[model samples]
Target: MTRRLLLSHLSLMLLVLLVLEVPFGVFYARSELSRFTHTAQQGALTLAEVCEEKMEHGLSTDLPGLARAYGRRTGSRVSVVGTNGVVLADSAAQAQALVGRNVSAEPDIATALRDHPVAGTRSDASVGGDVLFVTVPGGSDDTVPCVVRTVYALGPLKAKVHATWIALAALGLGVLAAGALIGFALARSFTRPVRALERATAQLAEGRLTDPPTTDHGPPELRRLAASFTKTASRLQHLLQAQQAFASEVSHQLKTPLTALRLRLENFEPHLAPCAQDSLDQALGEVERLGRMVQGLLALARLENSAIRPESVDLGAVVADRAAIWAAFADEQRVGIVVADAATDVRVRAVPGALEQIIDNLLSNALRAAPPGTAITLATATAPGEGGRTPAMAELHVIDQGPGMSEAERHKAFDRFWRAPDTDHDGTGLGLPMVRQLARAADGEVTLEAAPGGGLDAVVRLQRADARTHRQRPGGSADADCAGNARPHGVMAARGHP
Candidate 1:
């Protein structure tokens, strides 16, 4: 797989090289041909001028001498032609073809007769082929006119251009090969680090972060990632060890009271008076409280050991159901309970039971601290951000109008067994901590703030459900809107009717 990946990258690089170099090679070859044509034309014209001088003197007066001299000087075939297109003097065709013979139909010669010397490249069988032809008319005073023509063979130029093309083709192939090699090296360099990281993550998932990794060589980012994974693994190992220790200690602490409560119950038949029964009931309540504490401790341990799985839930109904259960307890304590009607349809994504437990714990704590006539405010709604289409999330706030905690107390509120110093009320003091654990486990968060005027306020925030899962039922109450006391909140706000 790795080799295939590297080869794929190399192939792409080679393809790009081909795209850029092919046209450039063709264009460069054409440019060299153009330069060759220009240089040949200039030399041919110079030879034509000299040949015209020889033509003016005729055959007896050094015509061959001048033509031979001109041909030798310019490296071209020099010839003279009369106005009737007959070859008069020649340098290459053995200077003997001096008779009248019409040769005006030749493309290059005919063009030069009517216009400036028609200098261009042409290929022919005789005279070493592929030559530049140039013809110029010459006379003394426009009375007797003759044309001098020169042909410079471009065989050497063509040979050099062909050789250059071969060399460039080789160079282009080399460049493509070199690019593929470089690309292969780079792909290997990049993939090696990622493959190492993948193996490390697999080990970590299997709880094997106790030892360090073997290979630590790669780019800086990969090195940093390895370091981070090692650190995380170390921390997780320590945390698991700590949780096991805590679980053991908590279990030991709860066992003695549980044994004592069971013994007391077993021996209670001998003391069955009304007053004795009442005292025994009070002892049983204490035993139940201890059991609840142990259960909460187990829940906390499980939270540390487990991972979060988030899903949609309606918090409004969770609050209302909790309020209903606590309403009976609230009445017994002479406290007024009010579950706000407005939150009946609000919903958010979270663990269903965990969120309910958080709500229950917070409400239980609030009821303990709240005054008799004070109302506990349970509200649910969606929170809006600065900009964008979707609302941020759904929020559920449980407010109590009791005496609020000090800043110091608020900070310590979620700590296990760290209740406020002033309160003489008996409790396991694990309520708030358990609430926090459950909130975090549900991929949600919990915050404590001062209630309106003064009191404890517990707020839970979570993501809203997708639109497909949200449906409005007109006559439905909070009970029906939420599944198991959890309902939708963030969606209700998005319809602009919040």
Candidate 2:
């Protein structure tokens, strides 16, 4: 969460910098070029005035020396041209040879000779690059009309502009770095309370009570939310404790009476006449079924009352082990427990022993309904997502070749103590509800489907260990796929609808 927040902050900062700095840098570059051109033109006009004064005072003999001195100081090529298009003086090394050369066709010199200023850029071979030229009319009263021309190389000006752009880019980068640091700090501050709330919620779902986050020193809204959540969790904790205590008390209160009733009825078994023996048997059966129902309810209450977190489980290994244990019992009834080869290598997140209990209940239910010489198949497959919006899930199917329920019955099966009207086998119907709760505890789900071969399919869809959050219990195996992978094993005593 912090990373996402920081990235969003930095992205906005970069966009702002680009919007502002890009135009500013472009404007500065163009403005710098304009100012450099203007300065050169002004300098050329001043030099022209100096030349006019020297010519009017009869100092034309030192014209070349004046031009040379000006060029040396300003890093420019200076030239004096006569109105008749002859070179009067030049600052170049060949000035002496070109002192009287006719240069009237030269564009800048010709324009200046006609009394108009010349200012712009053009390619210059002598400098091996572009140059800025400024020419101005000078000394019209001289024996020969004259002009002054100045040529300055643009390399240094362009270099300065490029350096300024680099500086702006560097400054933008520094600002972005600073923004990232500040954004990270701010994101952490806000998400600290969120993290605490998440952990507390998970604990509360697992039947544990936890205090709300106290270090919620972030925004005012988050602080208020924390306080409200803490209050609600506290209230819920009290309610759960009271309910658990009630269930425990009720179980304790009824156990002796139920046991005594069953025993008292059995004591009458030998004394009762043989004609009334059938009545006695039915009475005993009802008491025994009632006792089982009570135990099933207590199992469900305990399942809800305990605090337990889900972790990664090897779906393949679990199915194989459970199937093996149930195989001997299945064989005695002329039924088979088959674990499909495709069921291997499946890892999913589930409540610690919830898969075993789910499997056992489903298998026990299947065994009761399945006919002799039939097989119960344990299969697993990966369920694909819908357009990548839904995450993939690991599906464990406990399939039985037995009488299947209709859609309405399947829908009602998950309800506590619900059984189909036609069901003849003894079951309290707590198993499906318990199975669903266990699946949900791991952020998964469960459903009942009619098998293609006209049987029941108990489909448990669990989160793929990699697709959802999970943590290994201390000392648990690191890899669930290894041949020697070990985990705690147990069979919970709860049977499903037959």
Best by lDDT: 2
lDDT of 1: 0.64
* Regions of candidate 2 where Cα sits further than 4 Å from its true position: 4-27, 52-59, 94-98, 139-144, 166-188, 202-211, 268-276, 311-321, 327-334, 339-349, 380-395, 463-497
Backbone clash total for model 1 is 11
How much lDDT does candidate 2 score?
0.77
Which digits, one per residue and each the tens of the lDDT, describe model 1 over residues 1-498? 467876787677667767766777777767877886676566655545555565555543565566778788868777777777887667775546654667789776676666556666777678657777767665444533567787778777677767877886787678767866777787677777777667666555544554464346767777787778778777877887788778767777777878887787858957688768777877776676667556556655655554434566766766667777778777876787776655456567665466666666666677777788777878787775436544366777888887787766777777786766676544667767766655655445677777767887778776566433222211101111221333222101000000
In candidate 2, where is summed lDDT lowest over 10 consecutive residues? Answer: 474-483
Q: Write the per-residue lDDT of candidate 2 for residues 146-168, one digit (tens) a residue.
A: 88888899899889988999999
Superposed Cα deviation of residue 266, candidate 2 (Å)? 2.9
* CA lDDT, candidate 1, residue 84: 71
Report lDDT (CA) for all predictions: 0.64, 0.77
For all candidates, the clash counts are 11, 0
